[model samples]
Target: MRRLMKLGAFALVLGLLWSCQDSNEGQQPQLEEVPDEVLAQVANLGFNADEVKMYDGVLFIEGDIRITLDQLEKMSPSDGLPVEEHYHTDNLVTGTPRTINVYVQNMPQKYVDATDIAIDRYNDESLNLTFNRVSSSGQADITIRASPWYYYWFGILGSAGFPENGDPYGTILMTRGYYDNVSNINGLATTIAHEMGHCIGFRHTDYMDRSYSCGGSPDDEGDGGVGANHIPGTPTGPSANSWMLACGSPEGDRPFTADDKTALGYVY
Candidate 1:
């Protein structure tokens, strides 16, 4: 199954994938251009290295998740998960209230507003995580920027990375066509919150099987050695309407469902 209109966190790279099309390698060209070392490293992490691609001089997996060479070289691997539960990465922002300052660059007004909506949804919760959008990029801990290029493929929504060293992933790159393609601000807000979920260490609620949310084929987004540890207290069965599902639809409007809150609270 392909993760539709999904994005990811940075830590996933040297370690794993943070994307909308988690298991389905996108139809984008230039797979041949990605270096063998990149492919080998991605493969080592349990991703589909054969589907890896190069975009705008950056290595991307699944679709838009960036994998830096420096990070690749420094990455270490591991494994071991709870029998059944929600998932998150090993590295997470540390604190009772992990307040993340967000900044947007060149995003449409709709997306800017959607970011606020998503942030509010997170802040309203009693979890340890909180997001506050800053007017200046310099004042932010995470900067969300619009991709320089427009969307030419079907599921090209956005991309990101996982948290590292007790800090939220540094940046989130929204595909330029996202605002235009999604049906409403909440859909965009869902996408925004989803990517942030990766930054703060949340994995897809359906990580074990992308086909659960995204149809096509059943695929597991492997742990990538970073650990997709199950969050305690979350359901062992499917979580309906979670913002962190592997994919987002054009009209999708999921906003912090009850189980999502449980996952957030359990992790933080």
Candidate 2:
């Protein structure tokens, strides 16, 4: 039956991802969580271990998510103040020291291409960014995989990268395949930049907190602040022109805003 076949396919995908789903089901490993010392080591890289712990742990991500257009419409853009362009490498934080790669297993090639282009646009010339297979001793930046979910979506919500260890190391990305059926994939670049921004210790430019001196609606301002945290002139654009804005809005400009550069300089 078609239902049975679908279940079989789902199992197959899970097997490939975990390699030991059956044998290791419910068998939690006894590896140590990131320690304070480890966090201190990457303090300059961005990301706080304590904060990351809120989301860290074995995750059962259903790469096969199904979000309806109505659901998409329901999701609101984050409400927070934009991050001021004042990234301090000294203030960076982290948990463990590891790198991850992203892949879009069943996603379309066009989405993949779009992500690559976004990376090219954001990375400075000195970065010389490129994607390749991850290796233990080679270049294992991050590995992204395309999802098999008919309705694929990505965001900080399900991503474990934020609450992860290391000095806000990078996370590679890919898209789910079936959604690839549709066209006009304009959001891919915005998605990548948004996610990558998290990896580099940049929070949502519009993260809001009422208790702070920069008071306003909580999370009303985006993570990137007025001019963006970049070197002067390098990340030219309106503070609001970043690609990492809330959903439903047209994509932000391609170039990195000042906040973006300041964050990058903090880590790299």
Candidate 3:
């Protein structure tokens, strides 16, 4: 009986050791270090490392902004681009309330898809935003114009919305080629998001954060302003992969981040 008891105790100790080994083997892998370029992008976007968190390996980030169309329009466009003359119109000017007309000149399907995605981003209730095919006589609030080459350059360009001044914001011209490629051939969703961001009052930036990127720097008053830049959600980039700035990165694509969703909530 004493020998049997000793054997039982030895077996129990071995079982516990084996269980511990199995548990260690099943543990999730540790995260790899973030690359410097990604860190730089995160820093530029205005996110702190402490503000970023990872869940199931994906990063989540949130930002708060109070920008308006008036703020964007008052800012100047990029220098190489032609000066944009401001115009004004109202949703009630023609007795139609809250109706904003969009004329899609080329790449109709892509434009439609973009509208769908944009609406989805806004939870299917984008305010005062509507679309139609091109019309010669109908005074439209926005128009999209593009060519195959232009599409190759930038998926979409220009945007029209009711600025604070209240004139039917003029046309948002897009390169048909980029839209076609992005929609059918290339299927590049990031540029579409970027252009839509422009439509909704966002701009390009090497930085992704507003505070960290713009900290101590004078507020950017140009077309590619600081307010429109993205904010970081991960030590690597804005949320693990952001559709806004990732298109231009070595990773070559960025989906949407929580920061983007937050900004959309503000705009939509």
Candidate 4:
């Protein structure tokens, strides 16, 4: 999660996200304890490299991205975030007319409906891949679940991973308990859509320097070994209204901009 924001209540950043996982276990076992050497390795691949945390056996970086040592061990680092608008990762769902099954569970009914709206946002477009909301996990190419209870207390809205092996990232974790506190169901839908973007390999529109939106020193979250290649037709520079910006405000609803549609069509 790059960060989240409170709905006009002093703007508590609910969060932003990206994720990865692997079988290379015990690379660092202590919960909540991340070693400097590991941080160095993570930094080498191009991430924030600051305040990396271990929670529930997963490495959470840049607020909500989950990455494992296995991916770091295997991936070849790519160039920094490009000075462009929408971008996609090197990995993608390669086949034509692909159906990405999405399942949402353990969340509110409003959220469930919002998921549909998010799905609709994409389905309305004419991309090679289509997102279908499945009723069960067995049929899902991507599953969205409520994050751990503590995540709500931690101000995390949602998290997801980039694509790998020509397949979409498998899961999304949305924070629980903020359903009512955060007004605007469409804003929530925006967050869900953004996570879906990640699972399908989209990077933050402001990836060149997250601080452009999140407000900090210009942090190039790096390629993190997975690759962040710029889309050919998107406008060059940060898109303030792009749904995939590194951080977002709680008050606004971020539908995909024209450039965003171009990026989706270009990559898919």
Candidate 5:
């Protein structure tokens, strides 16, 4: 009788294992379909159909390019030939002498000061592009806000949206804890400036070869019929001093290099 009881216990354990496996198989998640409009926009920007994927409601293209459905809907149609490795959205803010009013919200005093310093750097150049601080969020053209927690799982410093269809570019989102933990104030300021470059439609200087700054294999975002454009007069190779470099060093403080100024002058 004891021998029979041991065999019965083993059989019951095997039955439970099979039940769990069946449950897991039934619970498998399905892939969400990419919206037609979103796919068209991505294709227009040069991404192939296979390169674009929709997962968990977020659209991923070229591996690193993350877009929301709302943002995809807001983008304007693409135009112009690829120019310097600097990437840009087809949508540019209107008016030659554009006055972009920036509203700072929810950031600590230090970050606000850092943002002001960054704005001053651009204004000091006396280019056609100008950024002014405004007290009211409703009256502002660009809104800068700090995230309560780190949102970029990849350790990115910050991110900004591009100018789209008549919208005042997009909001700038900065990582709160990352900035708070940094000892160098200038490096923090550089991060703000880099994201600002994106706000104005500037892609990373090392967009073609991220290894220049990121120190890894050359990261080709992807081969879209439309790749990064080369701004007239900008260098063809890697630039160390560019404010728009993809990676930043905690000890490094970067101002606009000559090429960066040239690119800015050419665009704005």
Candidate 6:
């Protein structure tokens, strides 16, 4: 009788677990269909169109390049070098010598100060493109905001949007959890600067090889047109101190390396 009772209890728990699984499966959201043009644009970027999907009104391609529905409609596809060929975007920020206003979303004063430091770094470069801090989101070209705790699971400090179709470039999403955990001011500043590189159409310096930072099989991002465009004058080999490296360390507070300056100068 004791053995029978134990088996019965185990069966009951199993049944409850199965029921919960079914309930959760029923709650799963369905993916929204994307427009053919949007798919085509993604293909032009060297991503597979079939892999494209819309969720929560945002279009995700190649596991990155978040685009809002409105931004999708406005995107103009252009032919460019693939991830293997280049590291800069064909869709660069318009208006030569334009001032890009950056706004920091309401957060800790440290984040705001960090952003200011990043801005100073760029402004000091004396490049044609300029960065300025703005108090209002309405007046800003790029809005820097914090991400929820869940974002830390991706193991990235921050992410940024690329410039598309004359849209106000893209947003910078900084992981608050990562920042709070690491109190390195220069490292945080480097993180902000790295994302800013993405906003201005720069890809990872080691776009072809993420092993140095990400520690995985070398990723070409995609062969052919989907890969990153190699900037002229930048070294073909990997750069250890590039501010645009995909991953960052708490101790790695990289200012712009010589190669980084050359690439930025050549493009912007």
The models' CA-based lDDT, in order, is 0.64, 0.35, 0.33, 0.67, 0.58, 0.60
Residue-level lDDT tens digits of model 1 in 1-268: 0134433322223122222322244444433377787777776664546446565556666554565767656665652221112765555677656678999876668878988998999888866777899999888998988654423342345677766777888888775543455557777777788778777766666656666776657767665565555667777655776776766564578888777877777777
Order the numbered candidates by lDDT, best leading.
4, 1, 6, 5, 2, 3
Query: What clash count does candidate 6 reach?
Result: 12
Task: Write the residue-wise lDDT of candidate 6 on 152-200 in tens digits.
Answer: 3322234566666544455887655445544767777777776777677
In model 1, how large is the Cα lDDT of residue 142? 88
Q: Is candidate 2 or candidate 5 better by TM-score?
A: 5
TM-score, every prediction: 0.78, 0.44, 0.39, 0.81, 0.72, 0.71
lDDT at 168, model 4: 87
Local error of candidate 4 at residue 180 (angstroms)? 4.1
Clashes of 5: 6
Worst-scoring 10-residue span by lDDT in model 2 = 1-10
Task: Please give the lDDT score for candidate 4.
Answer: 0.67
lDDT at 192, model 6 = 79
Q: Mind giving the per-residue lDDT tens digits that candidate 3 earns over 16-117?
A: 323211233444444335445443433343333333322233332221111232332243322111101111111112222344455555445656565445
| Of 2 and 6, the candidate ranking higher by lDDT | 6
Query: What is the lDDT for 66 in model 3?
Result: 17
Displacement of the residue 187 alpha carbon in candidate 5, Å: 1.1
Q: Could you tell me the lDDT of residue 73 within candidate 2?
A: 32
**Local accuracy of candidate 4 as per-residue lDDT tens digits, 135-201:** 9889998898876654543445567776777788898887654444557778878888878887776
For model 3 the local lDDT of residue 76 reads: 36
Which ranges in model 2 have alpha carbons more than 4 Å from their true place? Answer: 1-86, 89-104, 128-139, 147-160, 163-186, 209-238, 246-254
Superposition TM-score, candidate 5 onto the true structure: 0.72
Single out the weakest 10-residue window by summed lDDT for candidate 5: 1-10
